[model samples]
Target chain A: MNHKNALTPWLFIGPAVLLLIMFSLLPILVSLLISFTDIDLIGLGNWDMIEFVAFENFIALFQDPLFHRSIFNTLVYVSIGVPLVIVCSLSVALMLNYMSNKLFSFFRVLFYVPSITNIVAIAVVWGFLYNMDVGLFNFILNSLGLQNVPWLEHPFMAKISLIILAVWKGIGINMLIYLAALQSIPRSFYEAADIDGANKLQKLRYITIPSLSYATFFVTVTTLIGWLQFFEEPFVMTGGGPLDGTMSMALFIYERGFQYNEFGYAAAASLILFIFIIVATLIQFTFNKSKEN
Target chain B: MKNRFEKLLITSALLIGGFIVSIPFIWMILSSFKSEREARTMPPTFWPQEFTFEHYINLFQNLNFGTYFTNTLIIVLFAMLGLLFNTMAGYGFAKFQFKGKEAVFIAVLATMMIPAQVSMIPVYLLLNQMGLTNTMSGIILPGLIAAFNIFLIRQFMTTIPNDLIESARIDGAKEFRIFFQIIIPLSKPVLAVQAILTFVGAWNSFLWPLIVANDQALYTLSVGLALLQGQHSSSFALQMAGATVMVIPVLILFIFVQRYIVEGFNTTGIK
Candidate 1:
């Protein structure tokens, strides 16, 4: 290393490092402290009104039915949503990579357009599609002599509606990742499989799936982490939904923090969610490690 | 011939896939031009029989979308500029060794796992104290120092041969000169990748801005759109118009930067 290296890194990184610590790291540390104190946004100046609350916020959250419901809904959303998104994306990816025709390239762009577009627009348009009377879905059902289903109005259906939109918005991205992975799988393996009299389906089953497992794991874990923090779609579309069927952990935290100004309680809830993500990440990392061996 | 049938099958699959994907976009644009009454009809037509720009006009007047558009642009530009400076620091971490470098790197990466949810209140409170609330700087300050961006640039810098830097040093170049003249010149691909990722991120950001930029005039595009929805309900045409407006800019950006966008993810070293 050059002699300048001793002085250079600090000189280069000093400003950024200071900023990250002060703006990002320091705030979270401050939050951990605030989570243990009953500090509301009454514009803090004197520390007289604030006092240590200990595990009271967490304890209260645990007792609250909304918190429990939020946890349940978050899990259900992640469990179902992640897999569906993965499958949809992976399928489209495979198809896009099945051949390099003009049409395939066009399909790639088509599938990806949704992923790149504004998600708020996606949620808004979907809200209309899920409208009970005016929606095209009901129109199709009515014309087909079937009963009109309320996509967003009902509890279970509302969850499904949000899932459908989420899948559409998300799948295109996962598809591209899977497509990239698919491209890297060696052609020689397929040639050998064909010579060994393996059919297309058999080759795909043995070769494609196993080869893409790493990408699958990566995609699923990231998607799950994102979904666990689900806020926008449900917040916009359902507003925690009919009978609290779709309240997610992130939205609940947002509501408690911003709406109620119950800072400590929200902080506790945020920590709980943070811990869930960490545990989930650890489990997946360990799983990948074992698979590697 | 048998090949003809195979081609037909593949072509059919592509057509169906394209249709499924493009329907929503087509519907979104189509519905935006329709009157609210026509838009809510059960049988959704592919196009408006009588087109109107009223919804689009209404958005500019009612929601103050021009300010939002400007706000998003300013935030995106400022964040990019801030990150460009940070990229210099990231290169230092990898290429320039110094005291406590490893510790600092580890510290930054460790903070990635700490979710933004926990940081929300304190950052807001901190900015409130500093009197930066409702300003673009408030939104941009926390994001200016990105651990991930630093890590990314550091990794990319490590890939450059030490011999190149050594030769530059042998030529009697100053430290800053080598960084600007040598390292920066060699780092185009990664710089493009980083810029696109950062741009998209700043453009789509919602939650932080939602908390900080409380005033309607100060609202960013995503926040503004959310507020537009809350303030005016049942104006399907107006919302679609607003949604379309919000989507177009990023869609245009993606079209130009598609290669860089994909390469950004590719550079993650997932394999």
Candidate 2:
């Protein structure tokens, strides 16, 4: 190894390392510290007025009904959204891999466009589509002689609308990941199966899915982490409306801190959510580890 | 006959899937040009019978959305500039020898798993203390140094050959100069990827901007577009026209950089 002077290395990384620490690392540590205090926007303006409150913020989070509802909403969403996005992506990937044509590859790129588009912007367009009197979805349903659905105004329907929107906006990227994985599988696997008189379904069962397990697990892990932190979509589209059925954990934390100016309580709630993601992620990883053996 | 039927099934399925995906965007564009009556009409018109530019005209004239648009562009450019600076740092971490570098790199990567929402309040406090709140800098400062970009760029730089660095070092080049001359020139792909991601994130950023940008003048296109949607009672169609205006930049951006953008998702997903 080329032994450069030690001081010189720090010189190269000094500015960037400093920026990351101040912006990312230090803020995270400070946030954890703030979770234990009773700080509000007033104290935010005057730092000395901030008072240490011990576990009161965490205790208060336990007492709040909205916190519980936020937890419940987050769970329901993660469970529903994670699996649906994975399955949709996997199915699309499978179809793309199975097809024999130039047009199939064309479809892949076209579908992936929305994956990169602004999630906030897409949520707005979809909010318009979910609009009761004027939305395209309700209009189409009404035109088909079906009962008009209150997509955003109703509670359960609002949550479902949020879920559907997430899956649609998110699936393209995950699909491409799986598509890359599926395409990399050797053709010999399928060819050998064909020689063994394996049908399409059997080949897929024995070879395709077995090979896709790694990609599936990776997609599931990241999707779970992302879904746990689901904020932008619900915030932009529904605003936790129609009896707060859709108030997510992240949104609650944001509203607690940003909107109502309850820094400690929001920070505590956020820490709790962060803990949940960590625990859930660990459980998923261990479960995946066992399945591998 | 049976094979033909199967082909028909697959064809129809693909068509339907593609149609569902494209329809929302197409509707957004169409509804923008429609009159309020046509927009809220009983069965919404699929195509505007009388296409009008009045809505587009209103978005520019009445709304003054150009300010938000320009604000987004400025913040986005600055964020991209920040991304370049961070990438150089990432390259240093990957290739350069520095005391505490490995520990520092791991520390930076570890922070990636920490949800950024938790830090929103503290960062707000930081900006408040610095007297930077409610400005574009409030939107841009915290965004400028991203852990994800650092991780991604370092991951890319680690793949570059060690000999290139050695050759440059033997030429008595300084670390920063070598990074700029050799590493960066060859790192165009990852840099392009970084540019697309940073630009998109900055352009579409809502939460941070929503919190920091307290004034109408400082609003990014995203927050402005949403607020505009909420403000207008006269014409929903006109509001859509405003959205079309907001989205046109991103769509045009994608049209040129489509491949890099796709490659971006793949790379980020890999991490």
Candidate 3:
């Protein structure tokens, strides 16, 4: 009976552990292995054809201009998009705190709807909205007696457009997160600030912002990681088009692995992406730690 | 005067932001009912002069969106079962004090940091090896028990009072019975939260489905919509119709249960 009790826990967790190992852990190891080889579609068919290239893929990837462009695009994306999302969400969350519950819930749903919709669908609508001739933005410009700006057609504008789409889909969850953190803040801190004759901005700076450091940190890290792996919107909206303007690292990797069937090179790119994410996350954590100190 | 001014400021800000935020959704729905020409017309009309369901009919006729919808439902249902299995494991971790449990939990948590992009190709290859590629099971297999979902369930289960489980144990209720009956029933709120999120996630999932399912019949709605867009790049109305089909179910679900969805993210953000 004691033995059975001991085994019961494993019985419960066994299936999940097994699946996690088979699907996640093993794949992670295999991907690392594959990154070192020339594992194309042909090698996928015949294991014997797989040749160990030992960082040759990585070496080749570094020389690949598209890979550099993808990395640069990803950095530009994460740098701009993450902060914009954070600031927007945090501002909305702060304002939300001042509203009535009934009104708050209404606005919450409005902000969150885009995030919940499929990116493919959002991309389609945005495509119409960004259409040069008949797109909504250009239409708005025409109505205002302004020359229509090529939104997705121009490389710089395409990156900005994709960033805008990302922030639209990303802000809801982060806003909700900030709201959660704000509500958890003790009321006395604000009351004390008020008694001290602190202005709203002063109180927000001294009290609210400091109080939300953890939420802000978590949001920053997660959103950065998300932006780093950005793919769908660019894929759907631009197809990484107009000279690979919106081609993200993740999309580049997808094109390599799936479209190009350069699985080994894709694996190498994925590992590099993985390393960048880890480094970024670690930097954020260290930054947070130093600030706390 | 000052308080009223501040209130007005906040209200206007929220209203303006809300309008901007809701534009895509409003456009998707309104454009779905427009003629293709009107949808693509310059200075795009805010309201369709004449509403039409032709695009809706066309989506089903040409795109066979119904098959994709059914395919998504199958994947979602199977994935839900897998989520329940994950929840059970979470319960075990929460209640049972077993050796190596902390290590296992940490291991699960650590896996969350490794982006799916890294493991995706290898996993796809593995699925191909198992002859699961291009099948619904292929989509369902890797997602069967996500580490993050397990972590979420564990966090929620830790909150369940131990007395109920202890009493059931005293009565000689089997471990599985206690888990299924006492623990699960008490965990309805979190379970509902997970259910709503999992549903939205599975429905909106794009990349993996795009990679795995080559058969058009087995394509999920998101993938199918992308395919529709590729095939009819200029048919704004038809694409909006496809987008509508994909968005409406989740949008409706959000309207009904958004509180749980918000609370879920508030507590356990894809952390």
Best by lDDT: 3
Write one digit per residue (lDDT tens) for candidate 3, span B33-52. 99988887665678998999
Model 2 ranges with Cα > 4 A deviation: A1-3, A100-102, B1-8, B263-271
Native contacts, share recovered per candidate: 0.62, 0.47, 0.79
Interface DockQ of candidate 2: 0.53
What order do you get sorting by TM-score, best first? 3, 1, 2
Q: Write the per-residue lDDT of candidate 2 for residues A131-171, one digit (tens) a residue.
A: 88888898888878998899989878888999998888788
Model 3 local distance difference test score: 0.88
* Chain A TM-score by candidate, in order: 0.95, 0.95, 0.97
**Candidate 1: where is the Cα deviation over 4 Å?**
A43-45, B1-7
Q: Which pairs clash in the backbone of model 3? A: none
lDDT of 2 by residue, B1-271 (tens): 9768877777667668878987778988999888878888877778899988888777777787778889888988898778877887787788776567778888877777778787787788888878889987888888777777887788888888999888878878877798779888887888887887678778887777888989998988888877876676446787677767767787788778877755665555452
Q: What's the CA error at residue B245 for candidate 1, in Å? A: 0.8
Candidate that scores best on TM-score: 3
- lDDT of candidate 1? 0.82
Q: Which DockQ values do the candidates obtain, in the order shown?
A: 0.61, 0.53, 0.70
TM, every model: 0.95, 0.94, 0.97
Among residues 3 or more apart in sequence or in different chains, the pairs in candidate 1 whose N, CA or C atoms overlap within 3 Å are none
Across A86-157, the per-residue lDDT of candidate 1 in tens digits comes to 888887887777688666766777788787676777888788777798877788788899999989888888
Error of 2 at A119 (Å): 2.5
Per-residue accuracy of model 3 over A16-122 as CA lDDT, tens digit each = 99888988899999899999999998999999999999989999999999999999989999889999999999998899988667887899889877777889999
| DockQ comparison, 2 vs 3, better candidate | 3
